[model samples]
Target: MLESEYQNRRKPPRHLVPAAPSQAEFSYTLREATTEDLPSVLALYRHYVRNSVVTFDEKPPTLRAFRAQFEHTHKLGYPFVVAQSPSGDILGYARVQLFRDKAAFRHTVESTIYLGPASTGRGLGRALLTELIDRCEAAGIREMIAVIADSGAEASLALHEKLGFTETGRMGKVGYKFGRWIGIVMMQKSLRRK
Candidate 1:
């Protein structure tokens, strides 16, 4: 069908619609997150929570809960960093937290990274994750884990792999979100140099 004919027949689905070319140059600085940044960070997370299965969270997080996480990460001496745009907006965030509460798991951390929808495809995700890994290594962290949604999170899986993570295991049908079954792929990267 001709382009005009196709337009008249049916409107393109929102997800299928082409996005306007980004006009601004992509630029951001990576730095440790502050208490003041908790709100913006949560907003970025809410974007995924509401629209995608990338996160298993079915509801947006409350500020108090997010604050507690921020505090806990810091209290454990883990890194919580953000990518700030030139306009002072938070483009994305990356952080590491204790993988488990047991003392035996002290050297193991779980890495989590999230970028706003508009920040996707830019190099921010890579930069943010790299910084997180570097910080973890600097702090004597021995291992980093990435638990990614197996479905609808291919980009995250690919990013982790590009950063030298390897799949360790997978648990199928472990989560339910958006009324659909989803699973997790566990990826691990050694932060300690041999």
Candidate 2:
């Protein structure tokens, strides 16, 4: 069919991405995540692992594996949060895990956050991250670290900086993924409340 004829046929477009919701229309409840949220959390995370360079994990973790990690963090009294929409959907999730397994690192935590594709640029990340910081402070966390990819994650880096995190250091060409070299930018924030 000619282009004009095809247009006249009124065939619907395919694979179109929906526009992000505006701040006025977007609202969510921020709260601690539960075991029941594991599946949704895992699915949200898999989106990043499969499609984005923000995470170093080239392969998505299994539900069982993610559950094990979540349980460990919960058992250790770390903060795990989910931002749920009014209609009961997990728009994003955040967590703080031990920075290292050593005893000297007990007071330090590494922050991780992931938002759904349609949820970006709607202020959801900032809200989720602020909640994570507040919870980590309440949990007596002295330090919070964010490890972000050097490629295609500038927004995350800027968000961390806007929240009082400083670029502590960087590792160059450490992550090899998607047939290219990627690095990490490490930012840290002191959570010691005066």
Give the lDDT of residue 108 in candidate 1: 97
- CA lDDT of each prediction against the hidden true structure: 0.92, 0.92
Q: List model 1 lDDT by residue over 1-194, tens digit each.
A: 89999887798778999999878788889999999999999999999999999889899989999999889889989999999988899999999988999999999999999998889998888999999999999988999999999999898999999999999999999999888899999999997753
Q: Show pairs that collide, candidate 1.
A: none
* Tens-digit per-residue lDDT, 1-194, candidate 2: 89999886685555565766765688899999999999999999998888888998999999999989999999989999999999999999999888999999999999999999889999999999999999888888899999999989999999999999999999999998888999999999999662
Q: In every candidate, how many clashes are there?
A: 0, 0
User: Runs in model 1 with CA error above 4 Å?
Assistant: 1-22
TM-score of each: 0.87, 0.87
Against the true structure, what is every candidate's RMSD?
5.8, 6.6
Question: What lDDT is obtained when candidate 2 is compared to the true structure?
Answer: 0.92
